[model samples]
Target: MTTAKDLLIIAIEVDPSGPVGQGDLSLALAGAELIDLLGTRAVTLTGDRVLPAGDAVPEDRLLAEAVASLDREAPYETVDDWLWRRGRDLFAAYTAVLEEDGQLTRERRRRMSFAAPRTTVAESAARRRALHRWAADEPVILALAAAVGIESEQTEEEAVVTNDAVTTVLAAVHDAVMELEAVRRRRSFENAAFANVWRGA
Candidate 1:
């Protein structure tokens, strides 16, 4: 009995688009194996990989990092004012990605609006919370085989190929999520320290 990880290694070792679609099939199988490993409901393997859900970090820290990052790029002296401006920008970018990917229709996008009262501490906190939730829950990879209408039960070789592709996507998505969380944590720490300095003054 070959393990999912073992199958993944094999799939990764071979090129997907060789003389045949062996590589592609292997990749798909890898994804299926990963889905089994990661717990299906926790993540949905939509396109090339599973969509990640759950809070990656605390709400306050997530917001502070976003504000700090935006302020560093632009110029904002106060957190209250900065939250209002950056919140809109962040919402726009988030919606744009969702729309472009067909995750949300035009009507849906129009109907949905981010309402954060301007210059209020509550508004800033809410905006940060929403952004953190989005960042944490967004799907990292879209599984390819299912998107193309490939069935799981095919041949031994085909199953192997599909598993390989999926595993590759899973590994990449996992790594990316880890990196994002790490960066978010670092930014949160920096923002906390900066906020303390502001308080001291």
Candidate 2:
């Protein structure tokens, strides 16, 4: 199954300069993995946490490793931490797979280097078409939006086209995060207000 991770590989392949910069690529790629896992019903969210829905281990290397990693710290973990940790490793693995699958052409010397190599997409029209379709995918759009912090009401509202359950789960989580953020903002305002009042006194 071509996942969000695969689509991200395509996005980077087509544009070596991606939507997000090098420093944020890991987080975006990791979020792509979560999007894949969530969409496939391989995992489910529980109050902003993620847990495997079933015992079936995946055959895909990335999926297998992700499920396995959850085991080491079972009883589930925060989606934030899990995605952050997984993003770093998945970026490397997916990049290698893209080169192996002929989707990306990389300089041999660059492969041996510690940093990511300069790479380009394959010259296949069919592969490009598939990627174009995936890029338009609602989940992919959501993941990309998330990666760059591009807030869009249209994207969230459009998420129903993918999976209503996933959209609902994400919305619930979003509400919680926003609420906490609002509280923090309010507290900061109050703190500043009191400080000004004390200075005036």
Candidate 3:
């Protein structure tokens, strides 16, 4: 399975204290795709900029589309730029693909009697592979998971991710997630103040 798919499965199957932000998850998924591309030598990073290495198509359909979307011009897309652009609604896209591929199944959320059923990652080979990778403390996948607030078996310093390109993408993902959180906080404060004014506080 592709890194993107594996990451998505982990996000769904793991029981975090709270739901992962769709935006943060999407950005990480985009970063995962870039890391996978680097693994295949389909693309490489010159500093933070993405440069296509060849015309080779990726085996996964989503990854193949990612290759097609690369910027081939001078001053190629920065890793940060690619994250936000390609990551737009990326979680939803991956969800659709997994569902269509039968990697996702639905079950009743037992705790909430009024709650609608939710789609959960199925018991499949893809899921087992992802969980095994998670258990093995794979640095790239763990780093991506951590960026979205999922705790890993090993801390960042202990994991010791060696590849510079993967490190670059993971750093970009962390920064983007931070920026998105800051925006959320700012909006929340603004709305709170607006509510106070409306209530003549």
Candidate 4:
């Protein structure tokens, strides 16, 4: 029986050239949103629509709550171990669904390839690139929900809620990217200033 414990959470984010302090937090929030969306979709699709509507919270807050809820409900030996395992599973499921639905292309597939028995290094590089692009695109929320088995909906309410959730999450991602860019620029300016002031004799 696949319980909530079997489900995994993985945060996705836009990559900053240099690390930003908030990058991890943003990604963690994104992952939580994906988990929440997926959990909701899973229950609904399974005819077990008991989970609460996630319409009230902003995307980041929703994600935070989801993570907290998962922590309270799931038993794991260590937090890091739990996160790593969950990330791997979610990534695999997300990639597979994208491929099946034609949302993932051959070029993207090449970019997101990995070193498996039949794949070359070039393929692995391509796979990595594809995954990076997808991460940058910020489709993890919808993709993860689809992976857990959400299909085309007939109800206006479901459609509206899902669309709103996706939009909210994407907006949060854009803000995170901009924030990261600002941090990178600040670091660059400071580095240049320090270098210019210290002339080695």
Single out the weakest 10-residue window by summed lDDT for candidate 4. 1-10
**Model 3, global lDDT:** 0.91
Which 10 consecutive positions of candidate 3 have the poorest summed lDDT? 10-19
List the candidate numbers ranked by lDDT, top first.
Answer: 3, 2, 4, 1
Clashing residue pairs found in predicted model 2 = none
The better-scoring model by TM-score among 1 and 2 is 2
Model 3 clash pairs? none
Q: Is candidate 2 or 4 superior in TM-score?
A: 2
Worst 10 residues of 1 by lDDT: 1-10
lDDT of 4 at 80: 32
lDDT of 4: 0.37
Q: Evaluate model 4: give its TM-score.
A: 0.33
lDDT of each: 0.35, 0.60, 0.91, 0.37
| Most lDDT-accurate candidate | 3
Candidate of highest TM-score: 3
lDDT of 4 by residue, 1-201 (tens): 011111122211222122323333333333444445555552111121123333444244323444444332223223233233334434344434444544333333445567332211122333455444334433443343233332223332332324544444434444444555678799999998889889652
| Candidate 2 segments exceeding 4 Å error | 72-75, 107-117, 124-126, 134-139, 149-201
- In order of appearance, the predictions have TM-scores of 0.27, 0.62, 0.94, 0.33
RMSD of 4: 13.2
